[model samples]
Each structure stands twice: as C-alpha cells, then as structure tokens.
Target: MAGGGGALEIPERQKRGKIVRRKKKKRIGFRIDLTPLVDITFLLLTFFMFTTTMLKPQIMEMRIPPEMYAKVEVRASELLTLMLTPENKLYWYKGIADQNNPPQEISISKLRALAIEKNLEPTVKNRLITVLKISPEANYARVVEILDELNQAEIPITEAITKEVDEKGEPVKRQRKFTIAPLTEEDLKLLQGEGK
Candidate 1:
C-alpha cells in the first residue's frame, strides 16, 4: 500500500505468467540419438581390434604313436619272457630264449610269484617282460585272469613280443628260431578280391 507504481509483485508465481505456463511442451522429441551410441560402440570395437594383444601360446610338435606300430624296442637281456599256452598254462623263459622248464605249467600263484620275482630283479626293476602265448584255442577268460594276476602284483608288462610256436605244440629246441607270420589267409583273400 504505497504509491502504485506499475511494478506489481504480489507473489513470485503471479509475476511469471502465460510465458512460463506454455514454455516448451513438445520436449524437443527427447532425441537421445542412438547414432552417437553406435559410433561410440564402433569406436570401442576398433580400439579393441587395434590395441588388443591376441596372445597365441606356442606348442611343441610331438611324434604321435600310430596304430599297429610299437613305441619302443624291448631288448632280450632286459626281458623276463613268459609263455602262456592255450590250456591256461604259463611258461617262463629268460634271456636268449632258453629251455623254459623250471617254472613250467604254472598256476596263478606260481605265475604271480614268477612275475614278482622278475619285477624284483635288480636289473629288471622297471622292465618286467611277460610274453603271453595265445593259441587259437585259448579262451579270453584265461587271458583276463593272467592280466588280472599281473595287475594284482602291480607289475607292469609289455605286449611288445616275439612269438615262437611249433605246429606240434612241442617245446622249441635250441635249434628252433622265431619268425613272425607275414599275413593271414583271410588278409590275402581280401587283397586278392580288391585287386579283382
């Protein structure tokens, strides 16, 4: 209630009128422009592509074993040969293929003892050679039993073997020599059929 000058300041809200009420209602479409986001993503991808260290670990080339091929050679002197027959009989022979008579026709217990003794040998401590003679009449059960007995003894043996068998099932004499069979008749027939 002073002199009425054109300055009317009743309340702070009344001073700001229609201009404040209808300021900018459309909100400028709230653009958030995904183009910049895309550009940033591409920039990050490019940065990673150019600056990242794609480390490739080095590898050594190894000579892999092939099927039907032996890995190592077994020496005669270092081996304790065991001959297993088709009748579940086992024979023990050592060094230069001598007459294997002492531990002949051995059962599981005898076989185990022989294997343990050979394994315990000072020279053949690591190398216990057991040659299993499998005849055509031999059952797989016997083979498994022999293997299980060997496993029970905890003595490792090799299948790398030299076979010697007589046609008459007689003992191989000192004059007798060991030779590997070249091929089976079935294999020959298959080859012949292929050729035809």
Candidate 2:
C-alpha cells in the first residue's frame, strides 16, 4: 500500500503515437481513342473514290412486235405456189390435178413486181388476203429475194413451194417441198408444159 501511494510517477513523453490514417492507392485506367481512326478511314475512302475511273455507258432498248392472232387461209384452187432451182430458175404452180398448171420460169425483176402485187393483197381469204405456197427445192437466195420483195410490196406470203422439177420428169410421187422463193422454169414445164 505504501509503495503504491508513495510513487505514483509516470514516464512522459516520447509522445504516444496518434491514430494513423490509411492512404488511398491510385487506380490506373486504359481507353482507345477512335476519333483518329475514324478520320483516317474517311480520308482513305475519299482518296480511293477520287482516283477510281467512272465510265458513261450507252444502252439500247429493243422491242419485239407481237405476232398476229389470226389464222392463215389456204385453198387447193386458190393457192399460188413458187419454186426455185439451184441454177436460179423459178417456177410457179397453181390449181388442181390435170387442171393444175405447170410451174412458170420467171425473172427476178418481173418476179419482184409480181411478188409485190401478190403480197399487196390481204393474206386472209375473206379479209382480202391471198396465200402463196412455196416448195423446198427452191434456191435460198432467190427465196429470200422474193420474200423481201413481197415484204416491200406489202404482200402476205404463205408457206408453200413447188417441189418437183417437172411433173413429166418425175412420177409425181416426189417431194412437193414447201419453198419460200418464187417459181422456176422446170416447175412450169412440168405443170403447164411451157418450159424447155
């Protein structure tokens, strides 16, 4: 009790440590800058576009006329037939057996006029049209020529031809091939007995 009462001294002062505050740590962050990328991309695009070639193209539009819806008229008695030979001979045949006239050999000039006249008629029977049949043995050039002439003359030609060389020459069992050309000499001689 004496020791406790007599010596109540305390060693003072190296200054007891005050409450220490904790410091906050600094944070690092990363971000991508898109402004420069966008600008560079736009510049490259503009440069490519300016340096590229531009061409002006010309285009033509074509239209095909519709075909007529009417049917073609043909008759044994009324049909006109044309034939052509490799040598450029022309023959025209028309009408019935026995009464059917042999093909007539014709000239291109005269044939042209005839074709024009023939084509000028309406192709329809009651419609004022006439039909001309052609046989296949006819020459290609001559047939085209005749067709062209008919077209120019406004003639409506039909599909028929003078197939035989001469009715007398063959047994009449041969091809009566359809030709688009005009008549030849052998055809007339055979049918009309008019050719050499």
Candidate 3:
C-alpha cells in the first residue's frame, strides 16, 4: 500500500500455539498493455494520410532562342522529329523525309529509349537536332510530359514561338525556322500504318 501495493502480515492466536503470523509477498512484476498504443498509432497514420496534401511536381526550365535572324543548318542525318497528334499518339522520324524511310508510331514512354537507340547524342560535339511538332489540338499536359521527357534526357531544345512588336509597331508571332522539311501526306499515312 505504500508504493501502490505491498506485502501484508497478520498476527493471531491459535488453539494449539501461542501466536501465529503469515507474510504475503508482493506481486512485483507487471505487464504493460500496448494494444491501445498500437491502435492510436494506426489511427493517427490513417488521419494524416487522408488529410495531408501531396507535394507538387517540380517544373523544368528550358532555354529559348532570342531572335530568328541567324539561320542554323542541321544535317538530315542528325535530325529526329517527334510529332504529337490530336489523338495523343506520338510519331517519330530518324532523318529527313524519303520514300524508303518513313515515320514510325511510337509510345510516349519509348521516346527516350528510341533516342538512345538511334544514337541521338545531345552533346555539343555531336548535337542531334530534335524537332517537336505538337499539334494545336494536342493536350497541354501531353506537351508538358514530352518536354519533361526531353529535359530528363538532357536534350537541348532550339525552338520557341514568341510574340514581338514588328518595326511597324504591330505585335506579330515570331518563330525560329529550322531547315527541316515539312511533313507530307505520306508521313501521315506512315504514322497511320497505311504505308507499312
């Protein structure tokens, strides 16, 4: 009773003996019930999982060309064109347009792999010219994903559309033009598997 619980001793007179006393030992060892603690921990975990907000994805920054005055010529062998359609399908071409070589339809995730497969080194010494033709009807999220993939692959981007005030003081859209040829109907057929 002194410190929670303790031994008790009793003194009494017996019939045959003069006096008799008994000592009772205290129960020292005790067990702690951790069931409530475990339950509380799980409840807190569930609450935080349901209430807390997930972190936003980090955005990648790309360098844009200032002016289109200076023209740069990229070789046909060093070109890789990635075209995004309105249906979210991706089509890629290794080099310049030709009857023999046609654009192939590829998946979004395989872009990086295809770049590596075609040996499109994004270094300054052997720069691979990559042109991304994103259709106006394409989703902005798909374009962002493609840009992210390009950045993740450490490829240098060379194109940007900018609005500028012309010498006549009128705002006009300006874009740097590469020497790459435009996509033809044959290219579309190739992408659609008709040219296969």
Candidate 4:
C-alpha cells in the first residue's frame, strides 16, 4: 500500500502471490510573465508617436472678384504678359501680344528682376498689371514657381509704392495686380514660331 500527499499508487501481484505498491510521478506546470513584454510594446509605441513627423498640406491663397462678367479695361502699355508653354519655355512681353512683335523668351531665373523693374517703371509704377497665361500641358510645378517669384517680387514693390497709411494709421495694403488665364490657341501658335 502507498500512502499520502500528491502521490498515486498502483497495486501489483507478485509471482509468489504477494502484492506490491508502485508510486506515480508528479508533473510540473509552466507559467510565463507578460508584464515586461507588454511594457516594451507600449514603450515602442510611445517612442514612435513622439518621434514621427506629420506632414501638413501646402496651400496657395487667391482672391477673386465678385462679378465674373464685369469687364475692367486695362491699358495695353500697362500690361505685362507672361506665357508658359508645354515645353517649359517662358515668354514675356509688355503690352498686348502681337504677331508683328512677338514675345521675348526669358529664363525663369531672371523673371524676378524683370518683374521688379517693370513694376518700378516711372510710367507704369503701381499701375502695371501682370497677366499669367498657362498652357494646359504645362507643368504645375513651373506655375507654382512663377507664382512664388511674383510673390517674392511683391514685398519690395509694395515698399516702393509710397509709405502712405490707411484710415487706421496702418500701412495701406496694396494687392499685387496679377491674374491667371488659360493660354489660347493663338498664343500657342505665337510660341511655336508660327506667328513669326
């Protein structure tokens, strides 16, 4: 006979008719601690949350007139037209674009200086209107670049346009005189040297 705590016994019969007792073994159970693993997981999550950079959407602001059909006549002498072609070529001309006198090709790098010079001209100071005509096939990035240059040119030009104050004694806000228009077929023909 086998006795006691946590032990199992089996009875066996011997060849001489005597009974024998055998003991059974106990099995151990295993357990794992998940606290450290959970802590590391949370730590990595927090690290990424604190270190990751979030991208913000870039935007350009434009103001449009209330009346779409209203025609405001602009003098040809005060007009500065910039035409962008699909080939990434830039052409600029003062006054109206005429086939007899084609637009002069200009590089993007020199555009800023030209804008400043034209805007500061004695005859057209504070009155020059810049018209940007973009071809549908032109790169959007190039248009952005041109707008950026025009914006950069605004600061100095605004400063030069009299330091007069408004009714509130704040410096008068002179909006840049620029507009965007779609390139016409005639303009494309002019750029392709067909008009010449």
Candidate 5:
C-alpha cells in the first residue's frame, strides 16, 4: 500500500506572513500471497512423481528349445549332465553314469573354465547335449549362472524328460534332443551319487 502522507501532522512554519501548503510525502508497505507459491510447488512435486521412473525387477533371458527339435534323439555318449544343489555344489558327469565314469563334485566357480574346456573338446564341440539337473531347493541365480556359461560357450539350451534304456539292454530312449531335466531323487542317485 502507498499513501500520500503519514497520520501524524507536521507543525506549520511562518513564512512572510503567508500560509503555504507543504508537499505530501510518499509512504509504502508490502504484503505477500503464499498460496500461489505453495500451489506451484505442489504441482511440480506431483509432476515429478508421475513422470519419474520407478525401479523394476530384472528377468533373465532364456532360449527355449523347439518342439520339433525335441523330437530328435540325443545319444548318451554325447550328453553332459550337471547337477546343482542348494548348497552351491555342482556335480557333473559325462556320458552315461557308470563305475568307469562317475560324477565329480565341483564348485560353481569352475563352471566357466569347464565350459571353455568343453568347448574345445571334440566330443563336446558340436554333438554335445548338456542337461542341467537343478534341485528344487537350488537358488534361481545358480541356474542363471549356468545358463550364462552355456551361452558364453555357445551351447544350446533345452528341457525334456529322458529315458535311460529299454528291456533289450540298449539305449532305446535318450535325453531327446538338447534339454534340461529336473533332478529327481532317482535321477540324483543315478547321475550324481547315492549319498547325494
């Protein structure tokens, strides 16, 4: 607000026996409205809240083997089975499990090196079928790690139920194409060990 003069009056001065009107002084005051400021602040906050990106869970990419591809037979001699436990223990075996070639216990840290070695092996270079027999209680990260290693080695991923042999003492059914099989108690004892 502005004013022409203050409420208090000044004393008159005698000048040449004639009364003269004095010029009024300018006065100033200020008032601020905070409602608009508060409204704008809230609008900015709401805009950021709606426009900002929130964190999302990450999912691992997987390559699922085709159904027709699954129909192709895989030989036991060309198969490599890896058993993963919840304790991070890895048991791997090449070919059919027998007294001559038994499952060897290893650590997860050795998988990358093993993949590199297998990639160079003639038996596993191209005809190899790796079956991941993961336990139900195993951590999901363990499976992802194995899959990543396989990817690094340029190995194909698969999932299928396999058969060992027939009544004729011959491998009538095999790990049909390239696939990952769940580790059942029977499969664990057969592929890993009885103590597993």
Candidate 6:
C-alpha cells in the first residue's frame, strides 16, 4: 500500500510487448573565420603591386632659345621657306617667298628626301635655315607630319669638319634647322595665284 493513498495496483505487461527510448546527441552550430582569407587577399594585392612595371611615355624633344623676340639675320640663299595651305597642300621655295621664285607644290612623302638633298648641297650644308608657316585653317596632323619629316632629315658630319661630338665620342649628326611663323596674307595670295 502507498502511504498517501489507498493501495495502488501495478499493471502487468504481456510477455511479447516492450517500450524503448533513446537519448539524442546535442548538435553544435557551424561557424567560419575570415581572418586567413583577408590576409591572403592582401598578400596577393601587395605582390602584384610590387612586381608590376610602369610604362614610360614617348615624346619628342625640342629646345627653345632664351630670347623669343631676338632677331637673327640669315642670308637669303640659306633660307628655305615652307608653307601649308588650308587644302592640305604643301609648297616650298628657296630664299625669299616671291613670285619669281614662286612656291612649288610638293607632297609630304617627298619632303624628307628634298630636305636631305638640299641640306647636303655644298652651298647649303650647315647653313640652310628652314622656315615653316602654317595657315590657321590647315590640318594640325599635316603640320606635325611636316615637322616629323624635317626632324628625321639628318646631315652626316665629319670629325675634322666640326668639333661637336656626341656622348659616345662619335661625330654628331646635324639636324635640320627649322622655325615656325604665322602665315601672312601675302603668303595666301601667293598660293591662290598659283591656282593651288
């Protein structure tokens, strides 16, 4: 008998029946750390920054005189005048720009050859001065091409003729002497009269 109640009866189970219970294991939550991944990413970025090489810009070198207004007298025979028209036409003449020695139309392709031939002449060598006058309406690219052609024209020099020597102690190559000036009204008339 139970002390708090009347006598308690226990129920009997059949010999073939039984009950079973199993304990469940506690599950742990999944977590991911980003410290190592961040470190690796920074390491790769720094490696690329330190190993990459920067490219240099290509440019042409030009030297300007100290005095811009200073007038330098040059002989008429040593002067070579070049004019560019709005029609992309190029004209050149030796000495002064006049009707007698009128501007002859020349293609830009032949400019280098003509410049070299004139500069190598016995009378004009080392003394020839090139004057380029470009019209405001002329193509800028044509102007640059003309300048590049002139720059590429070089005159060979002998050690005995000139004392100038390059950094390598070799005879220096003489570049074409050139100057830029504004195209005047007279020059335009010359081109128009020539039927160009």
Q: Judged by TM-score, which candidate is best?
A: 4
Error of 6 at 133 (Å): 0.7
Model 6: runs farther than 4 Å from truth?
A: 1-57, 155-176
Error of 2 at 130 (Å): 7.0
Question: What's model 1's TM-score?
Answer: 0.41
As a whole number from 0 to 100, the lDDT of residue 10 in candidate 4 is 31
Q: Local error of candidate 1 at 23, Å? A: 76
Candidate 5 structure lDDT = 0.65
Q: Pick the candidate with the highest lDDT.
A: 4
How much does candidate 4 score in TM-score? 0.66
lDDT tens readout by residue for model 6, 18-127: 33233454688888999999999999999999998798776777776677778998899998899998888999999875657888999999998888777767787677
Tens-digit lDDT track of model 4 for 19-112? 2244444668888999999999999999999998898788888887777667889899999999998887899989976766679888989999
| Candidate 4 residue spans exceeding 4 A from truth | 1-46, 49-51, 66-69, 164-175, 194-196
Question: Relative to the unseen true structure, what is the C-alpha lDDT of residue 58 in candidate 2, on a scale of 0 to 100?
Answer: 50
What is the per-residue lDDT of model 5 for residues 114-192, given as tens digits with 9 covering 90 to 100?
Answer: 7556544645444567788888888888788887776655532121111334578764332223467677887666654
Cα lDDT tens digits, model 1, 95-160, are 544224233346766676677666657575455555544555557677667666765555232221
TM-score of 3: 0.50
lDDT score of model 6?
0.78
Compose the digit string of candidate 3's lDDT tens values, residues 12-60. 2232234234455566998999999999999999999999989877756
Q: For candidate 3, what is the lDDT? A: 0.61
| Poorly placed runs, candidate 5 (over 4 Å) | 1-58, 65-72, 86-88, 155-178, 191-196
The global C-alpha lDDT for each of the candidates, from Candidate 1 onward, is 0.52, 0.48, 0.61, 0.83, 0.65, 0.78
Clashing pairs in 5: 158-179, 158-180, 159-179
